[model samples]
Target: MTLDDALAALKSHVEEGRAEGMAAYHKQTREVLGIPNPALNDLTKSWRQTLTVEERVALADQLWQSDIFEARIAAAKLLTQARLRPDAAAWALIQSWVPDFDSWAIADHVCMAGQKRLVADPSRVDAVEGWTQSDHMWTRRAALVVTLPWTKQNNPKSDDLAIRDRVLGWAASYVEDHEWFIQKAVAWWLRDLSKHDPDRTRAFLDAHGEKMKAFARKEAGKHLT
Candidate 1:
């Protein structure tokens, strides 16, 4: 389908008055199509089933360039699959969107899609590591957000454990960044990691909790004990 057709399909699902409320909630200045997430989820699922990877990537790029909030969300959902062979294009496109991230809502959705690609190719973390040093807080935050899958492995092997530790090193470096969102991302990674590796979580807290914002420190320790 063409971009016009996809935009038409998305516009068809907009809810009356929800757009205004969503815009305010997300602090979004762009066009906010008041489509609920379930609708976008269903829409992208069908699109994924029908569209080839190249088609979906092209469409996702169009939707993202539209700068319409829900369309961006749909773009992210369109590529959120766990397995997409030769996903280099999708991964690269997602990377291209990083510098454009200005809000948590869209960034989180795209980062979820990114988690799939990163897990599909863990070596990509090398590129993601550079994001940790970016001046853009959201981009730096995306580094933690996308790497979150490493936190959930119940019985991690040597390499998975190595990745998990590597991401922790990133989190540790973030402790000095006092931005609320950055601290939250660090806490989020640790909180999730705590479920699967409490000892590591506690160790992180013991070593760096003294420097963390109280809320983040509490959040990182929430699952422990």
Candidate 2:
């Protein structure tokens, strides 16, 4: 099917799932977060069945331009399945969605899967690193999460200290962020990294203990003795 067809199908699927009065909740979330866009928390429970890589890419392109949050989310879901595809165009489409990310759901949905594609193709790491420093909190969260697979794969080693340091630095900068999502992301990265090297995490925490926010410290405590 063509991109238009895929988008149309996705939009219909999303509209069917839209909840009454959800607009109020979306507005409240935006107001509380100081974000400018309308958001929808509801999402499809499943992806479109077995979409071709090209079809998925087309859907992603269309969804990227959509004003509706669910449309964009649907696109992200489709892209996750296509993450293993070797299409450069598909990767570009995936990368383009980073700046548009506005919520943890979007960041986690895309990054957890797209990260494998990125690590396999190292060129994508630069973009992730750049996002880690972005002013946008979601982008930074995406950067940290995109490395999750790598950390899980290699665990912590002296050789990977630089990577660990970078992740910790990102967490440190955002540890005290008032935004709950940002604080949670900081906690998550610390917790995930701690799984690799609990000792190093303890050292890092102790060294920067005074600097860590209570929430981060609490989360890190899961693995750090």
Candidate 3:
């Protein structure tokens, strides 16, 4: 089926329950100084069961052309789940859209799933590095979180170390960043990495103790101690 057909099929499934849930979440978010974009959440919950990878990509391109941020986020979600597809285009879209990722939810959705698609490729490291230095806080957080699944799978040591170092370096640089989501992701990355190599994490934290934030140190130490 065509991308338009797939999108229309998916859009028809946007239930009241999903919309209500999204609206409620948006309300809670607004109360906490967060951006309350509901379209992504609503679209995510309405994913189609039969959409093909190419159709999703086409939909993403269409949504991006239309400047529909929520629809693009939904399309990203769909592409991420189409496991065997080449993700170069999706990565390019995310890179171009990184500066626009003002919310932690959308950034996390893109990174967590989009990063999964990049694990086997060496070229993705450079993209992660560039994201680590991005001015956007969520992009920096995405750079760190994208490595989480790799660390957990205990992939080849070479790949693991490259991603590990980038995550730690990003966390170190943002240790004192006041952004709650970035700070929390820093702690979460440390906590996840600590499970893979407690001794190494302890050593790194010890060496960087003075520079590490309290929350991050606490998270890293949860299992190490």
Candidate 4:
């Protein structure tokens, strides 16, 4: 379907006063239609059922360009599938949106879509490595956000272990950033990792806790025994 068509569908479900409160909560200046996520999910799910991968990619691209809050989210939901064949377009589109990430909500929906892409092809980790060095705070944080899957493997194979350590290394480097979001991202990775790899979590806290913000250190070690 067309951008106008997709947008019209999105506007059809707008919940009157919700948009204003959502914009205030997200601290965003963009157009917020206040369409709740379930509606977006419902709409995109139907769209996904009908569209080809390429068609979905084009529609997602347009929705994102519209820059309305719900449209961006719907764009992300459109590509959130894990089994899209030849997902190069979806992956590339998600990567292109990274630099524009200003709000955690949109960035996170896009990253949820991206997590599947990265899992599909781990070589993309090398490209994601480039995000750690970006001047954009959210881009740097997105590196951790997108790689959070690496934190969930309880009995990860050697390659998975290596990837976990690599992400931990990035978290180590992030301890001194001081931004609340950065600190939270680092702590989030560590706290999640602690569930599957307590030893590594403890080591990270021992080595970097002093450098980390107080709340982050506590949060990171929260799951450790």
Candidate 5:
């Protein structure tokens, strides 16, 4: 379907009074449709099944440029699938959106889409390293959020273990960042790592926990106990 068709479908499901609340909660300046996520999820699921990859890419790009809250989210959901065998175009589109991230919800949604692509080709980690060095906090934060899969490998291959250590190094670099979200991202990675690899998680905390914000440290250690 076309962008107009997709947007019309989303607009049909909007909750009348929720837009203001969503905008306020997200601190977003863009138009908010107040469409619940489940509706968006279902819509994108249907779109994914119906549309060709090129069609989905075009629609996702249009929806993202519309600057409407839920449309951007729909754009992300459309690309969240794991099995795009030759996904160079999809990966490129997701990367293009990184510099524009201003809010957590949108960034996280896009990052979720990105996680699949990154896993499909781990070489993208080198590009993600560039995001960690970006001036935009959300871009920096996306590096960790997108690599979260590395945090949970109970029976990791040697390659996976190396990836885990690489991400941990990124987290350690972030420990000195006083931004609440950065600290939270570092803590989040450690917390998830704690579930499958407690010793490494504990070691991270021991080395960098003292430097993290108290709330982040607490969150990182919450599952440890």
Candidate 6:
């Protein structure tokens, strides 16, 4: 119920020897709890069921401020549900975390939670567009990662199609960035889009792939055939 109580619950799951390996893997300098994802998943699932929306928000904020790896992951999982009606607070809190992202593991988990909010209200993409212009790479990358749902629609309606293209425009803007993560995010969006919309994927590669890093270009075209 309290932040200390939630953190104590997280600490109870820490594995003794795994902390160093997790820190090395994520290249994160923060305190790593070494709690495996399955355990964190199970824990946060129970927390989500047991806690009210405001309680979850407060807990997630505290967990994130702890700067402990697994605690941050737990914070994200707490708000990852798709049907949190009137989720303005959850969505706002998730947005607040974007600029603080320093690792892919944390950013990806937060983005997963973000995808649910975006799906609940597509207009949120307008706010996400600002992330594309952000000076932070992780914030920029979050834009693509969170909008991934747009890639999976095999029979999207006109509005969904528009949203998909809007995200593609963001990807295109990122092509010249040359950062490994940015290129990867661009390729990830394109590669996933290739699965359901090969034409758009190919078109993206044809236009911007030439400007992307060679590895990213290859990845963007991986499923194009």
Clashes of each: 0, 0, 0, 0, 0, 0
lDDT of 2 at 206: 79
- Cα error of candidate 2 at position 6, Å: 2.8
Candidate 6 shows a clash count of 0
Question: Candidate 1, residue 88: CA error in Å?
Answer: 0.7
Show where candidate 6 strays beyond 4 Å: none
What's the lDDT of the predicted structure labeled candidate 6? Answer: 0.93
Task: Rate residue 26 of model 1 by lDDT.
Answer: 97
Report the C-alpha displacement of residue 98, candidate 1, in angstroms: 0.5
lDDT, each prediction: 0.95, 0.62, 0.63, 0.94, 0.92, 0.93
Top-down lDDT ranking = 1, 4, 6, 5, 3, 2
Using lDDT, give the best candidate's number. 1
Stretch of 10 with least lDDT, candidate 5: 83-92
Supply the TM-score for candidate 3.
0.75
lDDT of 2 by residue, 5-117 (tens): 65454444433334434445554242121222232222322334556667667766776575455555566666664345566776777777788777665567678557656
Error of 4 at 13 (Å): 0.6
Candidate 5 stretches with Cα past 4 Å from truth are: none
Question: lDDT per residue, candidate 6, 1-225, as tens digits?
Answer: 998898888889888899999999999899897888888988899999999998999999999998888889999999999999669999999999999999999999999999999999999999999999899989999999999999999899999999999999999899999999999999999999999999999888888878999999998888877
Task: Give the per-residue lDDT digits (tens) of candidate 4, residues 125-176.
Answer: 9999999999999999999999999999977989888889898889889999
Which run of 10 residues does model 3 get worst, by summed lDDT? Answer: 27-36
The local lDDT score (0 to 100) that residue 83 gets in candidate 2 is 43
Ranking 2 against 4 by lDDT, winner: 4
Q: Estimated TM-score per prediction? A: 0.99, 0.74, 0.75, 0.99, 0.98, 0.98
Pairs of colliding residues, candidate 4: none
Worst 10 residues of 2 by lDDT: 31-40
Off by over 4 Å in 1: none
User: What digit string (tens of lDDT, one per residue) describes model 3 on residues 62-151?
Assistant: 654443334545655765653545667666765666676666655666775567666656567776778877777777878777767755
